[model samples]
Target chain A: MARRQAASAGTSANEAAPPPEKRRRVRIKPEERYREFVSKAVELFAEVGFDAGTRELAQRLDVTQPLLYRYFPSKGDLISAVYKEIYLDRWKPGWSGMIEDESEPLRTRLQHFYEDYTETIFTPEWLRIYMFAGLRGVDINARYVVNVETDLLMPMARAVRRELGLDPDAPIRPEEVELFWTLHGGIFYYGVRKVVYGFACPIGKEQMIANAVAAFLDGAASVMRGFAAEDASAPTAPSTRRRSPGSRR
Target chain B: MARRQAASAGTSANEAAPPPEKRRRVRIKPEERYREFVSKAVELFAEVGFDAGTRELAQRLDVTQPLLYRYFPSKGDLISAVYKEIYLDRWKPGWSGMIEDESEPLRTRLQHFYEDYTETIFTPEWLRIYMFAGLRGVDINARYVVNVETDLLMPMARAVRRELGLDPDAPIRPEEVELFWTLHGGIFYYGVRKVVYGFACPIGKEQMIANAVAAFLDGAASVMRGFAAEDASAPTAPSTRRRSPGSRR
Candidate 1:
């Protein structure tokens, strides 16, 4: 599987250190060093799979294993730290400046989210870490995936609720979220299976994303349609006008 | 990860052949020994993983590893045979038979098909083997997942197109099939993730599936609305459908 091979290839590809030219006068901070080391370790562990060797990590870092533990406490701690640094930190709005567009609809903004997410948030390292997390089962990896996936949905949900004027916490049914995640999951898996694992999906990435977006729009519209259908019996959401079901469906 | 642990645990749990009544003998033609071995191997592999030890296989069969391989030349040969035996003959029908009722709407029938697919195809051994296939980056695992996922969608797509009186391969600017797979990816990943690395998904399986279905419906509806609006005004789906007007804030 290219994803499995990608587990290792992407590791060194995304080394934690600043490039040589940029580092000429840079003095790295202690916590920053720890984050870098931890992120690197996460990449390595994810790449190497669960039984990541400390010795290999040291070799990768070009530092002694003893020095490695000083920042984090143990191999387990380092793995956990990397898990948080890369995957956990990934869910938050890293591109705050990017998502601040006020005029665009949530659906429009989501396209950008998908782009950045596919590029930065859902990289091979992220997936590799995820694979290990799944393997570790009750370990930090699983916790990390669940937590990140949850957080990944948060910003989008907030955006949709804001734009659509729907319930933010109003018992958003499971299927509602499933639709969102399904588009997300299909894109993610198809990407991995294609780019990472080198599988042939019948469609290209643009088509895949279009399909996902279509599905998401369709799914979101249904909720409104269903809500509007209910509203005929009990009118609510007076802010927006409802078209006839025949007109909509 | 629970998926990984479950794989290991699943094997350990079935370390022994079933007791007297459990191993009920069925008459088999001598010509079908290969077939019989393949079925048994699939159950074992899915229950455990592709990397499952020969020792375990022997244990499950109440035979020694050497004796088990007599039918096949080597471990590789045996597993390959097992894969073909079970998947080639059986996997295509994962949930094919579950949705014979044509009266059901596309959404309901799709959900029904998914639920049945989950029950029949996602056997414990299937999880183990598939997960192992992913981790090892095995070609077969990746191939089967994409193939099976696509195959599962065939019935759903045909049903939808038939309802709309659209051609099976009609180019109606990418209909609900994309939405189906997009949502499917999410649900499948969540379930696969759960099985591989145990997690109490915030919602139950049924709820999760429902959520996905809703999303797909909503998204597809949105796309359809867009399609109808476009088709009404123009002969082709507007190029703008491919690109959201702009990104969300």
Candidate 2:
């Protein structure tokens, strides 16, 4: 009886209420709204890291909490979307082809590849968020590092050997990868100095990339041969040195 | 009247209260307590970053808020102390002399220097806290970078030129410093890989350091000469390239 009375009273109140005003609210498509939410989420997470609350995200997006959740079911889902957008989506498919293209000199190919790669990656959002995620012990960085090692660093190591007319079939050694890492890590550290530490790199991007390429190329062959000689002389080297992939030869 | 009544009541209650039990707590010296706070602060900052709270730090230390404040004055002071403990105090007074020591080969010196340096710095606390602070836009990284460049990198660049029979007094170009940075940054990234990203560096530290030293020495002369040629050939080069310190020569 009480529920019925309350419903009846509420209905009477609604009937007696004044008519709402006509408003000029813009209607957005669902697709547009979803894209907007994602872009805004990237900005938010990039600024505050993974701990950014949905309430703050909603506030930034000018959307309701339910609407934000409607787009992304959970924080983990949203972060996955972010990783895909920033890392996977921005990754150019042609990079591997560029690195392996036999027509171009290896130095030229590497310079072009890193110029393109750094352009894609050396932003505040990508750099800071990566460090943040890595520090947080998130596996995304580990996964990305593996991808880089398998696809980029290892292939480049082979390319160095081929360019130097060394036995291209020789197994990749851990030291070879470390040499390549010096080049890659040095380049990445330039970005870290600029973006993370806010220090000026002093050289323009093209010139810095050129310097790193030249330096790596100048030394890579010797480093590889040095490692081979070391491996040959060591009585127990094969058992001790960790092998890179395709080490069976 | 109300305040007086409450004060009298509190005094009466205290007078009527039973004697407190004798406690057996270990008394720590003030200096010891201060050291304990800084060590814990380093661990806390390394794990959770700069946003970690004093309340939590106090709880972790098993001390009162006032006690922490007495030792640290503020969060910034505690962090400064931590920075001093980790970076400044741990920096060896012998390193500059070691690098400048003409008695030993540059490679041998670098290997020894890095072995000693990594021993001092390759901790989870040192590595993670560095990344955290760098990402936080703290100037400590910038300060440290400058210190490294001045006390270590620039000197190493000069040493490289000296070893390679290049004009020992020739002005260190930006490219020379950058070449050395590749070596330094490469070694640092090894620590980052192991400590921060939890990736295994397959080679033993001694061998890896030796590889890096050999690789850097192999190309340092050519890279330096290549820059000299580039500088000589460019019509408008003097204005374009960034000059490192002592570029006036």
Give the number of the best model, judged by TM-score: 2
What tens digits encode model 1's per-residue C-alpha lDDT throughout A91-200? Answer: 65554434435567555566665777777644667776676566545466566555544555554554566657666555343334444566667777766666445565
Model 2 steric clash pairs: none
Cα misplacement distance, residue B61 of candidate 2 (Å): 1.8
Among all windows of 10 consecutive residues in model 1 chain B, the one with the lowest summed lDDT is B240-249
Error of 2 at A204 (Å): 1.1
Chain A TM-scores, all candidates?
0.63, 0.80
True contacts kept of each: 0.47, 0.46
Candidate 2 chain A least-lDDT 10 residues: A1-10
Q: Once superposed on the true structure, which residue ranges of model 2 sit more than 4 Å away at CA?
A: A1-27, A64-66, A229-239, A242-249, B1-26, B229-249
Candidate 2, CAPRI quality class derived from DockQ = incorrect
Q: How many backbone clashes does candidate 2 have?
A: 0
> How does residue B52 of candidate 2 score in lDDT?
83
Give the alpha-carbon lDDT of every model. Answer: 0.59, 0.76
- Kindly list the per-residue Cα lDDT of model 1 for residues B51-104, writing each as its tens digit: 567777766766556766678777778777766654565554546544435766
Go through the candidates in order and give each one's DockQ.
0.29, 0.22
